[model samples]
Each structure stands twice: as C-alpha cells, then as structure tokens.
Target: MENIAKVCSRLIFLSVICLFFAQAIIADKPDFKYSFGCLDKGDYTSNSTYKANLNHLLSTLTSNTEIDYGFYNSSYGRDPDKVYAIGLCRGDVKPDECRSCLYNTTNFLIQHCPNQKEAMRQDEYCILRYSFCNIFGIMDDDPVYTQHNVNDQSGNLDTYNQDLRTLLDGLRNQAAAGGSLRKLAEAKSTGINNKTQYTLVQCTPDLSQTDCSDCLLSAFGQIPLCCDGKIGAVIFTPSCNFRYEEHTFFGPVADVAPPSTNTSVADIAPPSINTSAAKGNDGNKSQTVIIVGSIIAFVVVVVLIIISCIYLRVRKPREKSESKLINWFIVKKV
Candidate 1:
C-alpha cells in the first residue's frame, strides 16, 4: 500500500512539472500566417525601343525591392516612361526581415509573374505591386481579393471589428508619420470586454501623403475577406497592408526617426538593419499571466509547507500511539 501511494505521488509531481513548462511555452509564442498578391495585366509598349527601355528599367528595379535600412519600395522603374509600382512591409518586422522579405519577393515577383510584367505578390510580411499605368494614390478595386481565417474563433463580430478598426487607424497615423528613412506603426487595443487586439500598418516612403492614405484605406476594406470574424488576420497589397489579431506577431518599433519624404533611393542611405535590431510587441497577456502565476506559485508553496507541517505535527502522536498498540498486541499474543 505504501509503495503504491509513493508511485502515485511521483506521477502527480511529474504531471505538474510538465504542466508548468507547457504553460510557459504556450505563453511566449506567436502565431504568424503568410500571404501574397498578384496583378495579372501588363502589356509592354509596342515600340521596340520602349520595350528595351522597359526591360532595362525592370532589370534595374524589382517588384518589391529593399532600398534603405528598413524601408521597402515597388519600382515602376520597369518603364521609366510611365513609372508606377508599390512596396510595403509590416511595422514590427526588423530591418533585416524587411530586407530579406523584399529580396525574396523580388524573386517571387519575377518567378510567379515572369511573363506578366504587371503581376504582384502580397505576403504576410510585405507586398510588391507594379504596373504600366499610374497606380499611385489611386484605388484599384478590380483585382482586390479578400482572405479570412479558415477557422472561426467566436461570433462576437460587432465588437471585434470596431476595436480592430480603431486600433488599426491609430497604427495608420503612426506609420504615415514615419518619415523618409522609415514608415511603420504598430499599436495594441484592449476592448472594454477584456478582449485584446494588436494592429500594425505600414507604407513605402516614396508614396505621397494622399496616395499612402488612400492605399491603406483600400487594403482596410479587404479585411472582411482576411480577418473578419476571426481572432487574427492580415490585409495587404504591394503598396500597403494592415493586420490585427489577438496576438502580438510584430517585432518592434525602430528607435530610428522617420525618413524624409523626398529622400530618393540615392544619396546618404540608412544602414543595413539586423532582424534582432528591433523588438516584438509580445502582447500584454504573457506579462499579466506571469505576474498572476508568480503570486499563485508563492501562495501554493506557502500552503503546501503549512499543510505538510500540520500533517507531521498531527501524525507524530498518532504514529507513536500506533506503535504502542502494535507492541501491546504482540505482548498479549505472547
């Protein structure tokens, strides 16, 4: 009986230790999804010289190209005659992530849409869109595609969307003011109902004021397809993208100031940034859990000690009595 009790206690202890480590791992991780956008139309100008010019322009620029430290751009540089394109990255991604994503997207744009010069790729982290026609600051609803979460988290639609919009808009304002070197913004909002949300918005630096705002608004409208009725979602295009979720997927806001609007890709550029150079939002959930858990752990330890002392204090006399009884019975039998 004593051996069985000891085995049961050992199992219980192991189970509790496993549970604690599992909780810690679950508390610190983030959920990130990926996506891309493509524009299907591109008719190179009929003039041979113009086509050559266009190809040279394209060879020089990629659909989504990393220009400076943390900023990204889309080059209509494909056709110098009619320059129009778009590039964007998330506000929280580090400069290296921004660069790496852009570099990979350059290949993606060329590979996925090789024959079609107008194609674009919209991934979870960045977007690359270019066209023969002027697409800046103008709304293009023709190729708009909305994607939402495959699984529904809850049916609390109204409150979720409202909180998402407010948080996103605030993030937008912050991104717009990011200036010449960097333009990105991220914010978190907790609803009155205690549901928490994280939002991130970003634009390419080359875009004009009106163009930046309009492109973001256009992407925002596509949320119904991406994030509506879900715990998290990302809406993006080659020009701009917005995302919000119950988790903090974004890394960190750069301490670097905004780049100048007119700062061209040329001249004194920003330094190459490392991915770890910036931090992630990490959400408030973990912090709250850790604090509460600490208090609970402390309380549990105190209670366990008290209970153990009480058991020992009570068992000592009883054990002595039991030993005496056993000895007395033995004497009687003898």
Candidate 2:
C-alpha cells in the first residue's frame, strides 16, 4: 500500500509539471478562439474543390520565394468556388517557423470550420485567413480579439500606462512605414520601478502606409477596452496585430536593455585623482609624448637627408657643366 501511494504521488507530480508546461507553451503563442463566420456557399460534398484551392494557396504561400519576408496573399479557383487567402508571420519569426505556424493555422481552420466559405485562424507566430470575398489590399478589423495577462502591473499605474503608450506609439509608426513588403516593428521601454515593457506591432504588407497606420491605430484604440493596466496584453485583428508584455515575448532582438535614465552624476563622474595614480598617468603621458616626438624627429632627419641628396645631385650636374665650360675656355685660349 505504501509503494502504491508513492507511485501515485510521483504520477501526480508529473501530471502537474505537464500541465504547467502546456500552459506556458500556450501563453507564448497567439490565441485563436473560434471561427468568425461560417457558411455553405455550395454543397458540402462539392466543397472539395474549395478545399483543394485552399490547399494549393497555402502551399504556395510557404513555398514561394517571397514568403521569407513573412507576408503572402493570393486567390485560387474561379468565382463561386474560389478562395482568397492571406498569411502573415511575425516580423522576427524565422522562415521555417513562419511556415510551420502557417501550416498549423491552415489545418486548424479546416478542422474547426470545415465547409465554411470564410474562416480565420491566428497562432502566436502567424495569422492565416481565407474567404470567398476579396481580402487583399483592403483593411478589415472585424473579429478583433483581445487577451491579457492575469497579473496586474506593480508600481505607479499612471507612469506605467504612459510609458507603455509611448513605446507602442513609436512601434506603430515604424511598423506602418515599413514599406510594401513588410510593416512590422518592435520596441521596449523601462516603466515604473525599473520594469521593462516590450511591444510589437505588425500589419499586412499589401496595405498602403496610410491604411496600415489606420489599421494599427484602430487596434491601439481597443487597449482601454481589454488590457488597461495589465502587465501584458495582446490585440489581434485580421488586418493588424499588436502585443505588449512585461517580459520579452517576440524574441531576443526585442529584449533591449532600458537606457540608464536613473544614473546619478556620481555614476558618470570622473574618478578622484589620487596623487600616486595621477603621477603614474602623467608618467605614461610623458612617455607617449616622448615617443611621438622621437618619431617626428626621425622623420624630419630622414626628410632632410633626402632633400640634401637631391640638392647635391642637381648641383653636381651644374658643377660638371661649369667645369667643362672653363676647360673649353682654356682650350680656346691655348
């Protein structure tokens, strides 16, 4: 009975660890709660054509040479049986990771919303959406989702909020202006009590600068509705997405160290001049000056020698000519 009890205790501990690990993994990735809208545009059996088109489109997205830039949009099949799809990977995600994320997203959509003419699925690293309607170049914010960390921010809430806004605003501008291929930006800032806040913003590359900006601004506007003073939060939409965390979430590149704004004058002040240390420094300086002077003097001496040689060489020719002239004069006198 004791042995059985010990075995059960170990099993319970393993189960607890597994549960924690699963939750951690989920926290790192974006959330996809459910499909936005589902409908049967055609017979459920005939929808195989639509599924084929979707498969082809998704495969093309990851396999395309341009997919590395992390944005792909295309339409497949004909109207009434056609599917328009868009895939966007996080700016910092690797090509392989982007592909994997997109693959999983497509599968998730198909499994959860089968035979639906329109569906959207979002994962941590990427977002994939398909519809019978045109989804390219147009900005859509419908089906917006918001999530926040359970922990409330510590310290002065006002300062934390301000810093968070500033950081996210800067990132939003950068991401909106990222150009035709990619519009994504990430940044970090020190908030209250020296806590660091990280932020990331991204939009589909097809949107114009103005459109991207507007899309992101709309998402930012929802912050108050979802994650006012939370330590972490994410706002996801079909056109744009942004997230913030007390801990770095996107990647190591976004984990920037906060500037030393709190540094005191004493921190950067020059060290006190101990007499002995000062004397040693002076000695080193003198040695450096002496060495520089010796080098200059040697260079001057070498230049002088070269000038003297050149001068003598020219003078020697003149002297030889003069001597020949004198000899010629003597010969004439003879």
Runs with alpha carbons beyond 4 Å of true place in candidate 1: 1-33, 43-69, 74-85, 134-142, 150-156, 177-182, 224-226, 258-334
Global lDDT of model 1: 0.58
For 301-322, candidate 2 gives per-residue lDDT tens digits of: 5566556556665776799899
Instruction: Give the distance in Å from residue 298's predicted Cα in candidate 2 to where it truly belongs.
Output: 70
lDDT scores for all predictions?
0.58, 0.69
lDDT of 2: 0.69
